[model samples]
Target: MSTVIKIENLGKQYRLGQIGTGTVSHDLNRWWAKIRGKEDPFLKIGEANDRTTKGNSEYVWALKNIDFTVNQGDVLGIIGRNGAGKSTLLKILSRTTLPTIGSLKVKGRIASLLEVGTGFHPELSGRDNIFQNGALLGMTKKEITKKFDEIVDFSGVERYIDTPVKRYSSGMYVRLAFAVAAHLESEILIVDEVLAVGDAEFQKKCLGKMKDVSNKEGRTVLFVSHNMGAIKNLCTKGLLLENGETKIYGEIDDVINQYFKKSDAAEGYFTSAKLDKSEVVFIRSIRLSNQTGRATEIFNTGDDLIVDLELESDEDISKPNIAVGIKSKNGFITIGNTMLDGNQMPDLKKGLNKLSITFRSIPLLPQEYFLGIGMRSYDCKTFLMTTKEIGYFNISTRMVDLGITKPMAEEIAMDSVSPFIPYEWDFGNGNIQSFNILNNVIK
Candidate 1:
């Protein structure tokens, strides 16, 4: 495959409090240094873009030393926490912003959807906006006309196509905007998190269109999103960014693993600060472990997973119900409540108390999952305290555990579900097969 986009040492720096270097003196100083073929004085004083901590420098590199390439027909996913410079990098690639340093090369015309209603004039009707966007992509009137009906149909806003976009809802705006960008004849497509503004069905449609453009039409795509499942599904490659710097770039799975590794929840432990005092019962800490009591976040299939929870209450209370839920990217896989099994929780004291919930012989397939805790009233009407995603755990299957040979395991198709169900195969000729039959393990 040929490289369609190449970037080397790309960076974008910004003043902390003001624009244009914050002062004319600083601007003149930068100009003088540049005129003398010297490095900008401000660049030397810039600091890493750590938003959580206060820094002494007046300039911060929103993106620093980014280097990567996108080949023809490759769909690259850019992922990071908020303020990680994912959007900045996309803007530079879209030519909406210039990098502070380094160079990039693009081999073909680029179409970008960076934000809701991006490149759309709110005063113009959606129909007019589509034609305007197509023209801006260098498509002639004839070309725009050829794809107009398809765009309108895909957007599903034909009734309002002639209505001014300023009157459209945010979702409608995104639907029309994305329809235009995706259907246009650009060799490269750049999309940021703007697709999130659309509904789930529209988002799915957009993903399909992006895949079709890259796989069927031989175009390149760059996508930025916080949705890991979507990223894993669509992108051929992944780029993980952190603190405005490249953390990992390679295979999508490896990059995603590296991203999860940075999360404190992945450590399988969490402790609440003393400063976070609650009027009612509150979680103090959470710890995950294997049946052996060794704290860990990684587990193999059929492992006994345990959760140790600590809670503190200001006053003694009766009927304090606690619930725990395990969730994957799609949705909740299982939920265990103290009331479910007719086992009432013990009365809470005025101090900290410890509790344990064990899930024996977990059959979840290989994937990342999160644990959430909720403290509710006895009737489950009021929530005293709730923390979603307190910790994360991973589950992988072993060939031996599955009672299958390595080759057979490799050949088996895995479904996208948690808590793999056990089953048996029987042939009328007196042959029967069963595997991993551990049942009723949640406790």
Candidate 2:
């Protein structure tokens, strides 16, 4: 396969609270350094793009020293948290924005859908915009006409094909814009997180179309999305970015695993120092552990999971309820509430309080899951403290350690969204059998 896109030492810098280097003097200095064949003087002062901390530098590198290559027909998934420079890299590749330093090489015409309504004229009707985008891609009028009907049909906005795109809903814009980018004759396609605006059915359709575009049509694709499942489904390669630098780049599954590891490591433990002091109740610390009471974020199937929380309340609360929820990538899988389970929490005092809950013989299939905790009134009317995702943990079955292929493990993970529960089978021939499949495998 031939290399279609090459990036070496790519970096983008921005001034704090300002645009275009923030002043004419800084711009002039940069130009002077460039003409003298010297590195941009500003590059030396920029800090890494870590949004969690306050930095002393006036400039930050949104993306720094990014290096990668894409071969013909390769689908690359860009994975990162928000503000991790995924969008910045895509903008530079799309030529919508220039990098602060380094080189980029592209071998063919590129089509990009970086955001909603990208490459579309707001005043012009969607019909005209399609022809206009095609013309911009160097397609002749005759060629645009050839693919027009297919694009309209795929977008499912045929009823409003002649409507001004400015009047279209965000979802409608995404549907039409994606249809154009995917159906056009460009050799390379770049899609950002904009697909999230569309409905689930459209998102599925778009993924199918992108898969066919690369696998069957021999075109390269660069995709950015927070949906790990979608990324795993459509991408052949993965790039993990953090603090504006490439953390990992290789096989999609390995990259995704590394991403999850980083997430679980960073969030598995928490302290009250990170919380807001204005809250009525303060959770000082939270931890996850195993049956033996050893702190850990990784667990095997059928392991007893433990949660420990230290909290303080400003005033005595009567009949308080505590809840813990487990969430997968898609959404919440199960919620354990003290009130619902008939285990009422004790009244919170004015000072420190510690709480713990044990979930026995967790039968979760191999996958990563997040934990959220909350405290509310007994009547479930007022919330004292609540956090959607405070920490994360990973569940691994014995098959993963026994050399099962990564894809096979992932397939197992996707097979069910709920934990495996104990069950018995009846043959109806005066025979009955009960088996703990997960426990047997793990034990």
C-alpha positional error of residue 176 in candidate 2 after TM-score superposition, expressed in Å? 2.0
Tens digit of lDDT per residue, candidate 2, span 16-135?
A: 886655589988998999999998788799899998999999989999989999999999999998999998998899898999899999999998863676678999999998888777
What lDDT score is found at residue 226 in candidate 2? 77
> Pairs clashing in candidate 2?
none
What's the lDDT of the predicted structure labeled candidate 2? 0.79
Q: For each candidate, C-alpha RMSD in Å? A: 8.4, 7.8
Q: Write the per-residue lDDT of candidate 1 for residues 1-443, one digit (tens) a residue.
A: 99999999999998888565549898899899999999888888788888998999888999998999889999999998899999888888889889999899999999886367667898999989989877876778898899999999999999999999999999998888788889888999998877667776787788888889999999999989776656767788999999899999998878876776635453667776543355477777888888788887778777777788888888787777777778877777766666454446667778888777777677776667888877777787776676456778776444445676543232121325565433322212244333333554665
The superposed Cα distance between candidate 2 and the true structure at residue 341, in angstroms, equals 2.3
Give me the candidate number with maximum TM-score: 2
Predictions in order: lDDT? 0.78, 0.79
